[model samples]
Target: MSAPGRRIDVCNGDADGLCAVVQWRQIDPAPAELVTGLKRDIELLRRVHARPGDDILVCDLSMQRNLPELLRLLDEGARVRYFDHHAAGEVPRHPGLRAHLDFSPSTCSSLLVDRFLGGRRRAWALVGAYGDNLSDVADALARGDGIDAHRRAQLRRLGEAVNYNAYGEDERDVLIPPAELYRVMVRHQDPLHMLQREHVIGRIDALRTADLDQALSLGPWREHARARIWRLPDAAWSRRVGGSLANLLAGQCPALAHAVLRDTAAGPLVASVRAPLRAPRGTHELCRRFGGAGRAGAGGIDALAPGDLAAFVEALEAGDWG
Candidate 1:
């Protein structure tokens, strides 16, 4: 195989994943096809049909579950570059594929991309870190980079806004699909400009914060294990806010694992689980059991019907983790 004339970029739809590619494309200035989906759709590589010598770039998606597809792509002569902070499983020694993976609690795909690009677009990376709630890390990076507190706050708000836009059962529930949002983001090399020029970030924040206010007014889920279980009505707003709610609750009570659930017309409840910032392992295994997916500290589900609710509660209550 030779250097690629065709290029494809695949990523998770979260702010970090999309932003990483934004920075990369901004720096490199290339017209590549984008392959992405909802935040939960990490197996995007399988959907991409690339020929040998096609340049493929993967960002923010996990390698642990997509090794076969990735290896096949490499074997078929696609030049691949992977940037992620999730478990890579068995890393391969392949000349066609390159990887930059680091699973630090504070690291996100954007920062990983920032590192791989030597921080050429550090500002956008700051926004991605903030969106991922790598607060201290984002603050450190932003502050050290001569980004004032005002700008830092702006980035944090923008991060939350973009992240909020990603929560949904499907594209319809969200204000905009992740791919559409990515298009808007890619047009701007700097997130700050997007924050300043577009009302998108502010609108997202307003919607999310208002929802959190309502969820909080409902009362705590429990005092046990320093966790709060919030039950919400099934609606687009609930779907959008669940992730932000989990983050808001967990941040307010760092020792508490936050489980935000939305009742659905059918199927198990839709849930968002945030490990106690202090105890990231608490809800990881519990979610995995009910056909839900998540990291040890943070992750969520599309749905968990009524029958599964009891079991979901049991696992949460079990608190059976190191």
Candidate 2:
């Protein structure tokens, strides 16, 4: 009898992706090769070299971006399972592939896994949801579980810190690589327990605090009646704080759309765009026009030409966010 082929788990390095895989492994306790990268590294499906009959699990990546590679994997006779909440342009029908995908703005990959697992490890899912910036959804779920506000706050903090650590130009900008962080995360089933026992969570929180302090000193570069934009210099700290700053500004001024632009050395701008909390539509539409992709509430542009910044800001200011 031949040995079974290897099982490979590929996911995004952010908290939602990491937590989804964590829940699955904790439930099955199976051995699998983990494939992950920094938050900006979404083209992870191409990294796997699985043979026929191997098991491949993917989470939290856009199928639209990975369609060709995914087709290659399926054609190579590998059995694959995919879970995501991103914009998947087209889904192929194949007996070897099982996909659990939802693109709703209020849903995330972790929440999908939570539904699959019937909430067996709900706390972990909550952490993932929180990491994805689904605060109200995660909080409502936590409330149903009878968790107090204090513990809920801890979970939110832990989630934010975990998600925050995923940013950076490369692994060098982060305190620890995300795959290594996942190794530590899978050890604890409860997120709060991880916070209590692991020093890494505290370390992440401290670093996030320092990064935020630096970012808070900067004022908006462009402010209009309906939108605002902040520009950060080309630095590791700027890359690390761009997304978090967008979220912070969205929460602080829920009436105005916010854009956090990080000046990149590559002569383009990397941007994080958040629609107003009161009206979280049109952001995905906005980013897609700039060769970026995300959900309605939050989206990002990998690269925006310097000359196009004026037009992008104008679009935000004039958009009908409903």
Candidate 3:
């Protein structure tokens, strides 16, 4: 028989995206073309050159941003299964497309895939959830699913390490490309096994510790009663640490919203905004004002003009988070 058409798996490079695809492939093993990029590379769908009879699986990336490409893929006679938690505008009604999407602030794409798989890989799902900074939700799921505290912490650390590996201005800053990481990931049914047997996890954990330590040494560039902002220079370290630092600061001061602004080489700022953990709202609202979009709890602006940093801070400061 002629070789079957290609099966491509495209996803965001973060832990949530990786774990989601990991779960799916674990349940249904197949050889597929893997397309993914760093955390900031959300428009990944455009990279796919799918032909008729090809199969595509997209995870953790935004449907809103990839709508046009999605429509085009359907027109080309490909079968696409999309799983995501990001903002999805109107979903097209196409028989070839199978969409599993949730825009709720509490959900992540991995958890959605876990739901689809009937919790066969709950451990991996928790890892993805923790990586997305849904600590509380992941913890609750762990508890409900009978995962011991020790195992839960291990999963959390693995999640954080996997997530850390996905950051950086580009692939060079990351220790391993996510596609390669996924190949290593799929070989094991349990993530902890990967942690115990593989050197990759150790390398990632060490990098995360180093990046976080550097981030901790810096103080807030601007501070207000309800919000805080940290300005980081355009460097590999800053790009690697930006989102993780925002999560750290939010955890340290649950009542204060946090924004980590990394100066880009193009003279603009890429901002990661996290609403107060105590009140996880208004972040998406704030980012939307500046031409960015994300969930309510965590959102970002891809490029904030130099003149608008002050205005962005003002909006975060003045917002009614209650």
- TM-score, per-candidate, Cα-based: 0.90, 0.97, 0.96
Across residues 200-279, which tens digit of lDDT does each residue of candidate 1 receive? 67777787888777777887655566467888888777777887888887788887667888888885678888877776
**Residue-level error in angstroms, candidate 2, position 292:** 0.9
220-320 per-residue lDDT for model 2 (tens digits): 89899999899999998888988888888898998999999999878999999998888878887898998888877888899999999888988989988
Which pairs clash in the backbone of model 3?
none
Whose TM-score is greatest here? 2
The Cα error of candidate 3 at residue 246, in Å, is 1.0
RMSD to native, candidate 1: 2.5
Candidate 3 has its poorest 10 consecutive residues by lDDT at 1-10
Instruction: Supply candidate 3's per-residue lDDT for 234.
Output: 85
Q: Number of clashing residue pairs in every model?
A: 5, 0, 0
